[model samples]
Target: MKAKTHAEEAAAFIKDDARTHWHDETLWHVRSNRDRSAQGIPEWETLRDTASATKNYVLSHLGELLEQFEANAKANGVEVLWARDDKEHNEHVYRILQENKVSNIVKSKSILTEECGLNHYLEKKGYDVVDTDLGERIIQFAKQTPSHIVLPAIHLKKQDIGEIFHDHIGTKKGASDPNYLTEAARQHLRKKFVEANAAITGVNFGIAETGGFVVCTNEGNADMGTHLADVHIACMGIEKLIPRAADLGVFLRLLARSATGQSITNYSSHFHRPAKGKKLYIILVDNGRTAQLGREDFKNSLKCIRCGACMNTCPIYRRSGGHSYNYTVPGPIGSILSPGRDLKQYSTLPFASTLCGSCSDVCPVKINIHEQLYKWRQVITENTNVDKSKQLSMKVAGMTFGKPVLYDLAGKMARTALKITPKSLVYSSLNVWGKHRDLPEVPKESFKEWFKKNRKQ
Candidate 1:
């Protein structure tokens, strides 16, 4: 089956007006929480500045810090592997599993694995990987991708999840109580946690100085899976690294606050060393990150803590739904990150924004997200073959706007046509805006015309 583009998928989502409105308001509530939390902190902006600076330094000395991290992790008895891209990364994990003869694995909420398509790879290779986090597991059972990084099943309602569980895992049919479903999922995941021989997790922060990593989860799934398994593997993007242990403090404070307005995640589990007798494996993934880093305009996108604050605050993401992005990590952050991976596939993403700058203002690391989106548009327009009609329209608009007389004449002509044209013709499929939205009522005369007649004396 062919996948739909962002616009097509979004068009489908907007067809469900009730769901769209619910999604928008739900995310707005999260954004409201974030605002209240940030307002509670007097040094919030200062923390953002510090976090941004630290990431800048980390990027500047990335090679050296990576080396330092590897040495420290090895010294702490954690085996470290570097994967240059997704193929190599998946291969490395598969090789590790084969050597160890691991048949089943339990995983926490790891967006990295999702991005790399690891579960499908492992499943095809005859390994059963269970996503232990409730949200992740729900989507896993649904055979769908995560709608949001932090809230994987945000696109789904309680009734939807209840029905899914009832159909797939045998929860009571039509019982949609939050507590009941949570306990049902808990029991189900607990069994997997006990049965799985290995566990994998995604790192939120990797400290280069200490050669340690941290996985923050509200569900405690990371700790549960890691502690019970004989072998624990942590997958991380190269951008997850920080220069020092103390820098972790700066991020931890900002992360949960900006994400869901929580002061801290319920379980901020740290993996400084492999537990005694249990093996630890760390896979540091590149996966086109270095290439993105090389681009001066977008390098700062790596500063993201994956708190998903931008997605929560994004107006388009709320209305369009995460599936619209057709990406693993969907929303504003996804739009910025996805285009770098495949410009042809994601060319429409940068345009997904209203350029309202809420994402930039809400970002704890100050990534200049809106500005980057603007720059990406210019880059796309310059490098790619734009549609002939769009190109001609831009040229005409540019020419008219560049000359005052032409602009005035064009404005008058446009208003006159709008007023005279039949409603059906004026609001036909030919008008993109008219297809979904109402055009403002045309005036009988221009504002300039009224000004000259009434007040020019």
Candidate 2:
């Protein structure tokens, strides 16, 4: 409850709800939907393969494609800005608001904005930014960062939101019904939407061929907010570009099914050109993403559709929960991606997974998430400072198993020592496995010894 940073919050969630079963089941529910949806399409696997190839092609040629996208977007009347980092990104947005003298803005759910800390930056610059999405609004009022990319306030119950509303909006106490709470949010956001001069949204997909951005939403908040505002801004990662418009068909089919098990989202607004009398802008953000793309093995992560399917399907993610990942994008995807930014700080996340490939199987873009998590561990241990105790233990373990004779002798000695040791020592802090499950019974002899005796018999 006192978690100030994303990592701290994630750790708190895992420790607090150790007994909760639904955390795992909640993800599995989405995974089941994903599996069913993928099965529904006969060419789903082929489609995923194609999407991966296309994305890789685009990333490899990103420099040229970005310039082309910018030129085409400008021709279509959408101003394009390139931000090298978070500070530049924030400054550009702030300057845009100041240039128009617009004070109020409405934004749909945007993980990019969250990543850049855009809301806080704008607030400090003296702009009132209202989150139009219901879940986003809930977390905004609570002064908390979104726990999940797709569902900002997924961790909160209706009762929890009811409390937030009562405190922030003076809604009648004890009104915990979802319908009433949603309507209250709608009315409040409607006033902001009408009064706002600009709206910002996150692009789900950006078609490089035609210079258009796509926003997918179940609530239709993006459409309404953009339509009403005088200016519109679409925030996107440079990696969001697809080679062509038809390529979106492949991603669109996989996005909803992998995300929430729906055939398609309620709305898929394709903004190829700006609306009449409205100014449009696109901010292409490269916050540690370009560096991630440079890595050969980890680059495939760029193809992620931001679908929660991987988290839903991961055994560790389900048990430890999304918040345990300790980043904006939680679950399997976040664990692999978070380490790219701060290798030492978020090192524990990659190790948290059980190396299950369910995440890869469910991924729309085929990111090979489990494999990437493994690769990150080697990178972190080699290039970064690991805990002293862990380093010493690993060194001792390497020495013990470096030679076959030494390994066998050490194994026998270990079994002998285990026989005489008290259960307390076996179950003490020395054993990480014991904390989670019963200690396995040590074998009397090596498997090779047993095999030799069995062959003689």
Full-model lDDT for every candidate: 0.91, 0.84
Candidate 1 C-alpha error for residue 207, in Å: 0.4
- Per-residue C-alpha lDDT of model 1 across residues 307-415, encoded as one tens digit per residue: 8899999989999999899888888888889889988788888989999999999999999999999998998898788899999999999999899899899989999
- Residues 301-403, candidate 2, lDDT per residue (tens digit)? 8888787888777787666556566678877889888888887667777877778788887887888999998999899889877889989989988988798
Worst 10 residues of 2 by lDDT: 1-10
Model 1 residue 179 distance off true place after TM-score fit, in angstroms: 0.8
* Regions of model 1 farther than 4 Å from truth: 1-3, 443-457
TM-score of each: 0.96, 0.91
TM-score of 1: 0.96
Clashing pairs counted in every model = 0, 1
Q: What is the lDDT of residue 183 in candidate 2?
A: 88
